[model samples]
Target: MNDADKKRLLREMIFYRRFEDRTFEAYMERKIGGFLHLYSGQEAVATGVLEKAVVGQGNKNDYVITGYRDHVHALKTGAPAKEVMAELYGKETGSSRGRGGSMHIFDPTQNFMGGYALVGQPFPLAAGLAMGCKHKKTNQIAICFLGDGANNQGTFHETMNMAKIWNLPVLFVCENNGYAIGTHIDRSTAVRDQYKRVAAYDMEASQHDGMDIDIVMEAAEKAIDFVRSGKGPYFLEFMTYRFRGHSMSDAKSYRTREEELEWEKRDPINIYSKRLIDAGLITQDDIKAMEREIDENMENEIIKFAEESPEPRVEDLTKYVLDDNPDPRWIGPLQK
Candidate 1:
């Protein structure tokens, strides 16, 4: 990539980090409604994988499906910042028209299938999409993302086996963020190494240092290449950690403050920024300017959409209930 392209990728990653920080603040202030999952510590994994996937594809034809801890992915996949914020705010102009809220932001236009709230639902859904693409002779690959917790689901096993057997175009990525809600990875699985989980299905899976953007980028490129070259389904497990609690209401007693601070030292943004500066790819002033610019842009959009966007009318509740027959005005005009 050229300097301009590199800078754009860096800036995009910064925007996701800063936007997520603001979303956390919004959750605390009671602006964002429902469950809020923060992706602060695992920025590099999403940022890095997305850069190559979107860049290499040349556009948004490729698909992405992931679990509820998905705001960052949604934003990076081309969903508008204001619309994402509004979706959290439960406004009508949201990506799902205020229906899905924070957990289920879907933008088919951007090829983002669904920000599925159910822990393991998207695994099979993603495989099915990949199968469809294969049958249709489309070159587009479906990047299915899941958490460590979701990997243990029955659907995950079935999907992996079937994807490999049928030779579907799918990249299975697990963001192993150490803990499943309040439970640690050790307690959840006998084998804490998530990449090894795919061994049963005879699929290609590997672990990578997800805190470093370059490391993740290299691994992700190989995974994508494998799938595109007719390797069927590939699995990638990213060893990462989340800075915030499981949700806005989490008491967070499962993890210690010292542990949190320790992970903070490996903060993806800080690590990447230092690497860029040390390598002379970017300067300290450049980083500062980038942050400021992203912050300003996000703030402006947050206010613009949240305050200006209207909520869907309660009388129109029955509209868009089914895929086959969508009712634009199901409830009709409200009676006086």
Candidate 2:
């Protein structure tokens, strides 16, 4: 990518990082609710690929599907910050009708299928989407992002095999953050390099440094081109780290303070921001202004979503529970 593009991505990543950091504070103050998964240290993978420079609207189409660690992806995909925050706050104005909560943010307009909470659940769904694209004679492909621990699930293997045999246009990204909800990668798997495991299915696989935005963008561009050229599936293993705990309640006993600090030194947002400054593409004052703009916009969104929306009425609890058919009208009269 060019210098301007790089600076744009650096800004986006920083915005996402700061937004999530504020989200944690909001969660504590009861402004935001539910399980909030901070994409903290793994910002580059999402920002680098999703930036308008690397991936754009074209005949070489693309789609992104991933696990529940999804706020960054949602933001990068063009979902409005206010809409996402409102969704988390369970407001009617949320992207998911204030119904899906934290794990099910879906915006078809942005092509982000809902985030899946079940381990490895979205992989097969992603593969099927790619298969449909091939059948429809379309060039579009789907990108599936998952964690290292998700590789252990049987669904992961099944999806890989099907994707390869069918020659489905899909890119499987494994964010190898070293730990899965507390367990490290070495202890969790026999083959530590998870990308190599794709060899069993004869799929193309490679690795990239998830922290370096440029490297991640390069790898994404290459894989995206290869898939668009009718090459079957490709797997990219990004070695990254999450600065926050797995969830709001994590004790973080699996790693040390030194380890956390060491990773912090390689923080994607800071590293990329510094790179932009060093390259003379952006200034500290510009960054300050950007941060101020994002903070003010997000704060107003939170307040609006909260004050203007109502909690899901108790009688409407079963309104969206069905799959085949859903009843729009309330099942019974309002209790209150």
Candidate 3:
């Protein structure tokens, strides 16, 4: 990558870090509601992969979907920070018009379908989207992001089988953060190696260090290339970590502080910043100025946008509950 590309990647990683940091603070201060999941430690995985997949590197028509830890993905997909923050705040100006809250951020224009709150739900949805692209004869592919825990779901296995049999254009990315809520992967899953599980379907699968952006970008480019070439589906497992608790209400008694600190030492932002400095792509002063600008933008602009945004009215509570135009045969008894 060129110096400009490196700088852009750095800026994006830093923006996500700051955005997630500020979001946690906002949640604590009661500025945001719903079950909040901060993508603090896993920034590099999303940044490296999405930056290469969506931004300039890959096809613009590609679809991106993920589980509830979706703020970073939404931002990387070109969603405005102010509107995303407003969504978390449950305001009328949110991406989902304040109804979906933090879990269900959807913007079809940007090709970010929606963040599924249910574990492993995106697996089938992604396959279905890929089928649409295949039927339409479009070069578009669907990138499905899920947690390691979700891999154990029956839907995940079913989708994998379908993708392999039908040769769907989908990339299944498992963000293996070591733990699924309070239960560790060992306790919950029979097979710890997620990538190995794909061998049964004869699909291409590999694992990479999620903390390194360059590594992620490389893997993502290869995976995307293969899928787009109509070689069927591919699976990638990112060995990443999540610094924060599963949710805002997590007591965090499951993991040790020492383990957390050890992972903190390998923080993606710090690692990438150091690489940029050592490679002469960026200076300490440059990084400081970039951080300062991001802080100002978040505090002065984005936060205010969410704060001043109007709340959704009670009368319109059921507005998006059902379809705007329903088929007569499909209409339910309640509607009749």
Please count the clashing residue pairs in each candidate, in the order shown. Answer: 0, 0, 0
Off by over 4 Å in 3: 55-59, 325-336
Candidate 2 overall lDDT versus native: 0.81
lDDT of 2 by residue, 133-188 (tens): 78987777888888998999999999999999989998888899999889987888
Show the lowest summed lDDT stretch of 10 residues, model 2: 52-61
If the candidates were sorted by their TM-score against the true structure, best first, what order would they fall in?
A: 3, 1, 2
Worst 10-residue lDDT window, candidate 1: 52-61
Q: What alpha-carbon RMSD in Å does predicted model 1 have with respect to the real structure?
A: 4.1
**Number of the predicted model whose lDDT against the real structure is largest:** 3
Best by TM-score: 3
So what's the TM-score on candidate 3?
Answer: 0.95
Off by over 4 Å in 1: 55-60, 323-336
Which pairs clash in the backbone of model 2? none
lDDT of 1 by residue, 171-245 (tens): 988999988889998998888999898999999999999889889999999999999778789999999998888
Q: Please give the ranking of all candidate structures by lDDT, highest first, separated by commas.
A: 3, 1, 2
With a 3 Å backbone cut-off (N, CA, C), the pairs that clash in candidate 1 are: none
